[model samples]
Target chain A: MFKKKHPLQSKSEILLRNIVVTAMIVFFLVFLIIPIGIAFVGSFHEWNPLSGTYRFLGMENYKEVFTSSLFGRSMINTLIFSVVVIIFRVGLGLGIAYAIYSPFIKYKSFFRAIYYMPIVTPMVAVAFVWKFMYNPQIGTINHLLGLNINWLMNPKTALLAVMIMTIWKDFGYAVVMYCAGLYSLPSDALEAAKVDGANGRQVFLHIILPLLKPMTLFVVITSIISYVQAYVQILIMTEGGPGTSTYLASYIIYDEAFVKYNFGYASALSFVLFVITAVFTWCSFRVSGSEE
Target chain B: MKKKIMLIAMVSALSITSLAGCSSESNKKEQTKIDVPTEVFGDTIKYDPNVEVNNGEKVTIELWEWGSDELFESLIAGYTAIHPNVTIKLVNNPWEDYWTKLPLALDGENGPALFNIHNSYHENLINYLAPLDIPIEDLQADFTGVDAHIIDGKVYYIDYGMMTGTVYYNKDMWEAAGLTEADIPKTWDEMREVAKKLTIKNGDQIVQAGLNFNGDFHQNYLLGLNYQLGENIFKEDGTTPNVNSDTMKQIMQMLVDFYEVDGVGSKDFGEKGADSFGQGQSAMVIQWGHFYNTLNTTWSDINFGVFEIPTFDGNPYAYNRYNGESTFGINKNAPKDQQAVAQDFVKYYLANDNVQVAFNLAMSTFPAKKSLANNEEILKNPSLRVLAEHIDRYIWPGPMPETVENSLKRAGEEVFYNGVDIDTAFDEAQATIEKDMKNSSFVSVENLYKYAK
Candidate 1:
């Protein structure tokens, strides 16, 4: 029985499968593995591509990145931005998903489409729109609210302003994901909870929430990785300014590589960022795996 | 087994093709080196417009610029019209991305053959620029301020225009405040007095800013003010920064007082000086000569006038430091034929007086050509006219390190937004700049300017 094969599993089919698998492996090696390998190797040198010069510096680039005050500030900013955006975005998305998933809700598809609209919209366009709306004097937010706050220029509020915009533009994605999770939940378990003296709140808190853990873990881990690498909004809106108030680790990497032409140092910074992202992702898996 | 062999054979063939695509062209023929004249313009060798470039081979030269796309397009049109075989392709990137993309582009084989250069980035870009083969004396005789650009008896690029900070006043706001030409400020004290009259408030909120330096203090104000106070921001060695001095503190305090003590401006008034002024939210802004064109193009309805920047006491060592609006440099890494064609096009550009006047006017800069100083079209711009009158009062500091500007900007922010003391800010800035200069390849140009009055 184990040696038996399907009629379609002929020599030509096996050869075709081998070719497809080989093609995919080659593609990944060329596009992804090779670049990562180069970055790893380039991290130890002082590389100036313009002059085609590379001088090995041992661990000097890494040491500088670790000791630099700007990098420290950038890390702190990134952590703050990521943590706050994750909490609010996840919380808001779950609540909206629950509300829309209920049978009592009308025009559910319309509401879902509205929430998903921002997810499909381009980040650059969204960032620009938010930047205009945040203008202190002539912005829609200020004009409507009758307030005179310099949203992007005030150091105290710059990071908070950026986080708010990021959450608004990104929470819709969470909503869509959570909605799919809620729909796929086992109905029998929820019905049993309802029958066993469990109220709607109790059912949701215990049965629904517990079952959605897999989806929640997936959402949280992806969000952590995405937000950790987030720099486009920062680039478009603040440019890490109001004096580096919104400076994230990713923005620093971009600045070091492109603006300063310190590719070696930037590669070192990128590796550090990669390590941090991996550590967080590993811990997330461990925690979720332990619960299972 | 035969099918498996065939599969392996096909995979090997695909892998070889992909590796070949990634490999460099080792088998290609070497490019022939074209001879560049040691003396491009002299008694025997003069610029000839009819000289065939690239040995009359049809060629396309890519030219990159951060701005003045229209001017370059028209120039390309003019050049191609004369030499029908040559096609000049123009690639324009925004100012912010140009610097970041330029070096990487130049490193590649398909980069532009010619591109614009800014003095601030010249130190880093020096290695990539092919020095002008023209004799130093010829450039000195033809262009003004070429001395500052000459390094080791070779000029990489010449400044086609001179630019410095100037006060742009909203003419409507000035008239509304009952100010006339006689009331135009000649000194800082007088400007403050006039600014107070123009400022409008709506119950503790500044509805209109008389003058704003929210974002430009580092570039336009601080860098220029020290020269007026008989001081240079850098030490005599030029490489060592000397920003933590009595003169710098005085300048920082004056800027702080503009918002905190004097009530003439506020940091929260607007995002940038030029944007606020264009929107009529600011009565005055300290901007460069290029703002003249910006206002005409972006905000044509706004009536504005230009005046020279005010002195501290109506007399000083110099008014401000000037930066060269440099011309394009040919890429040394480009193919020999492309480089030759680029050089020939540059020669054609400089030799034509009408083209010089047009370039300067389009950029709103003072012309570098001595012959074009009196050109009627060039003098038509009010900003250039003001620049012409006070051109000698401005000093060219040569190519400054970007670190100097960044450090000063950080110091300004620390003082204004971070609540750090002025002395501490300056000290930190000095320390940062010193470290950056020591680590980088920047060697300051000494005697670029004379500060003695």
Candidate 2:
């Protein structure tokens, strides 16, 4: 029956498909893989800008990177940021996606667009807008809460302040993604769960959550990757300030290369940063694979 | 063992790639032959001892300077039109972005044929520069002041501008605090007392501040203050940092007092505050004459004036004012034999009275030459004279070594923003700067002794 069902495509059509596939593969490898590779290499050498000399300094740059103790601090910061961000993105995204699927909301597409507006907006502009919002003296945040706390200045509160901006800038994308995922899934399973001894929480946890794992994994991995590279928010808001309290690994690498002019050290820092991220990625994929 | 080997190989590969990128970039810069300014026009111009000329077969001289383009262009245009054989091309980069981009830009295809760099940056690019061989007699004959341009008894760039590090304040704000420039105070104690009265805190909001103790400017001034205390931050020889001094501690305590003030705009003096200068957030700031432009542009409606920074108590009537001069030099690589022509252009630019008036109006900068100091049009402008008078008292000893310069800049930023005490800041700045200077891989720090804390 399977053999009978298979009617072969024309040879020209098959050739066309092969060519397109090959082109896509080459494009991805060249554009994506090569750049990352170059960055990896740029992270290791002591580049003398004048007289144009570059000397191989070896693991010394890497040794300095680990010795700095900043990587450890940043790893913790990044983890905290990712975990918190994931919960908000996933939970809020699911809720909004599910609610919007209903007919109760008026001008559904308009509300969806408004919700997705921040998602499509430039991060720099968003960060700036939020920067004014989180202003210590008369920002929207301060005015709304009547808290005079220096959001970007007070070391204790700087991260929290940044987190709020991150959330506002991000949640819209998650909501959009979740909307697509919810639309394509089988609604009968969710209804069946409700019919079979399931309440609201159980409906979500036992049936719908299982099917959402693939989407959840996609969102979680991408968010984690993004959080690791978070620079603009820090750059626009704090510039890794109040004595480097807000410094992420990415920010630290930028400072070493640009501010300090220690390009070799910066390259070394980047190499390690890539390695750490790769390991994190592998661990997440492994978890996803096992659950499946 | 397999995982370890894999890691080792990957690391090795990464290093190779990084080295490859750096080496290739440098080699490309070296291999490519490009036009440099001095090589184009060192000898062709009809050199005028008294006035500059633009002679030499229409040579294009490139100048990469950081300033108001209108000022530099008008100045160049004044000289170029007379000789009719030369044209000046101007490239302007902001101070913050210029340093990072310059070395790379020089490596790239569109790098300046002629570029101006700070003395600190000059060391890194010495190999890339054309060795200027104009005689001192010729240089002096063309200009009134060779001393300002002299680096190690050799001229590097033709000096321009009036620059003096001073405390500039809004006059209206000062009056609101019941003070005058006469009442601007001489000692730190006087400054604080005046600032207390000047501090207009309408609840937590500072309607007007008595001072904006900018840490970066403070650190630069602290070098002068260290001189006042009779010890340099870099000690007698500059081979070592001499930051842990009684006077240094005193300076740190003074800053802490400023930050410790309740509700005077900020606990930290931020870039935001500096940008908000005209908004009545700050009454006074220790800044350079370049700030004249910022004040005029940002706070055009506000009444403001300048004064010398007050004295440190330890130094009895000491003045350690510093100024950076923007200079024009004949590039070592401008076509061929263009030095004479370049000097002629420089001389013409300097001598033209109308050019001087236009520059004064456009930039509000002090003319570099002593001759231009009292030009009728220049003298007529009160703001120009005020700037000129201040820079007249400023002492310029060419440029510091790049290593000392960078370390000083970083330490200044960290100290000011992080609330680090001045002593520790100076100590760290000294230590890092001394190491760089001693290596002589950078500029020599041996001379820093004379300017030490």
Candidate 3:
């Protein structure tokens, strides 16, 4: 009856449909899918940009990227930056959401607007403004604190400085997400916790924290993805300065492709980053699976 | 009901047509016209008469002209009048980003038909460069970069024209020190003495710099002088870095002494090197012939005098580290006729005295050809003549060695800016270069020229 209603297509009709879809799909595959796929394949090969010769040397790029000090350092820098960023951002986001979610806070809308400002601000522009604010000699922070720090230039502090900016710029979104989670929480749970002689801290730890796990996972996963793809902050602030101390995987790929004209190498580097992101994303979902 | 359906479809189609028209119109505007300002070279030359069009090919070539595009467009306008078949489309960007993007675009499948390459990147673009295939004798026959473009036994690029660095001094500041252009110092010691006089200190902070030394200016301050010292940084073979050598150390120390021991360029002053010249923050600065051109445009009324850059450590020839040199090569993939026209245009731009005059006039830079540099009209011109004397020592600092070019320059910046020891900073630079060289696949300059014709 369904086949009769749909009227099983003739061979010619199927052929014509396939031809049209195939044409459109070929366009996409050639333009988008092919480049991305090639990037993945490129990671297994040792290709020289200038010579236009490629050697298929499986796992060497991965080996080199893992063993090379430059890549290793950048990886560590990226991880430390991400972990610190998540902690501060999620922590600050929850604090802000809770404070504002309370009945007593004044000018909630104004505070919300202020919090949203960095989220809406362009990443490049925010990084640039932050660059000056973290300038070694002239930065307002350094001058005010009377602490001599090369915030952007010094290897020791550059990552932290970058992470701080990342947190400030991104936490607003996390806050907004947490707000939704807080609103969705059952008011009866909080009331029951209070009736059980729980303080604000006890209620937060025992009742609110468990409820926010789903929102936290969402924020954390997205934040991790964003941090892995972090290029603009490093580009604008340091350009991976002070001896590759702040070089991240994304910026390395960017510099290789654009600055150094080693597109082959850059493509390979990108695939490695893609794999890392994919795995991390998978693990995140796995960890958050039962909690939801 | 049928009429209503048709009317809705027609309205939607009309809106789509208008949108498409608007986009196409904007693209037409983007494609046709480009404007750019040039540093004011004091001497003005005639404009290019026309783009060289042959056999009425009616060629439309894409050009990625970084700066001075408008002036080039004007010159092309004059050329198009002569040969209406050929049209030139010029696009420009800031010099810094242009170097980054243009190469990738040029190497891409659908990049420009013609583009710019600077001396700093001579080695980097060699493989991508399509051979001009002009035989050896015919190439640079007039010394118009026959050798400059020759790479691994083939012609790859030609200098747009050339300029050497010179000390374009502030006459106003020099006058305060009771020094006339006639009394301009020829040696570093005399220059420093004058600088000490020009140096003004209000309390502790540097009020005005006597001379602005671009810190981390390894090539300009040290390498140039090293060339004068008869020390070649790269072995003629180009493989081994003699950077840790005694001569290198001596050169490094001399530069270090200027900022540290002599104390001329200050960290506290905070005036950037590029801006210090025009802003009157520095009394004397050594930069390319374009500085005079820039001063002429931006600070025309400001009293300034142009002179030769001083020799360091009694070498009698001061080497200003080479930057901002350009080479043009045909796209290997472009049409046959376009290549011929490009070659003729370059030959004309470098050879024809009138175009040389226009280049100098419009761009405030010099004609790269030896013939024009020696021309009495060009030689008599105050700004460019002194720069010509230093041409023998002009080097691209060995094509901006991947090992040394400023990725790590920012790292050692603190040492220069905060008086970090020279040894410490040099070691860091050395380490970074070594690491970069290891990661990089390109052979050293020594190995690169093994195929030299």
Give the better candidate number (1 or 3) by lDDT: 1
Q: Which stretches of candidate 1 lie over 4 Å from their true place?
A: A1-8, A290-292, B1-46, B55-57, B450-453
Per-residue lDDT value at B188 in model 1 = 92
CAPRI-style docking class of model 3 based on DockQ: incorrect
Q: What is the C-alpha lDDT profile of model 3 across B1-453, one tens digit per residue?
A: 323322322332232222333454543343243222122111222123333357676788777767754345545543454566878777787886776566566677656666777656654556556776456565546544445445677766655555656676778888887977677888878887877777777775566778776533543454555555555555555544445456656765665676667777664343245466577777877666666656766666667777776776555432544443464656666666777766655543443344445455344456665556676646655677766665555544345554465633543454554355666656655655564555443333322221221
Better of 1 and 2 by DockQ: 1
Cα lDDT tens digits for candidate 2, B1-453: 323322322332232223333444543343232111221212221234333343245666567777555445444543554445666677888887777666666566555556665655655565555434556666565443455455666766654554555666778877766776578677867877777776777765665667775435444455556555554444454345555567666665566567565334355433454544665567777765556666666667767777656666624323454544544545554445355555555544444434434544444556655555676655554455654544433444345554444455445545655566666666766666554344244322324333332
Ten consecutive residues with minimal summed lDDT in candidate 1 chain A? Answer: A46-55
Q: What is the DockQ of each candidate?
A: 0.29, 0.17, 0.19
Where is the poorest 10-residue window by lDDT in model 1 chain B?
A: B26-35
Q: What would the TM-scores of all predictions be? A: 0.90, 0.79, 0.78
Query: What local distance difference test score does each model get?
Result: 0.80, 0.61, 0.64
Report iRMS values in order.
Answer: 2.0, 4.3, 4.7
Better of 1 and 3 by DockQ: 1
TM-score of chain B of each: 0.86, 0.71, 0.77
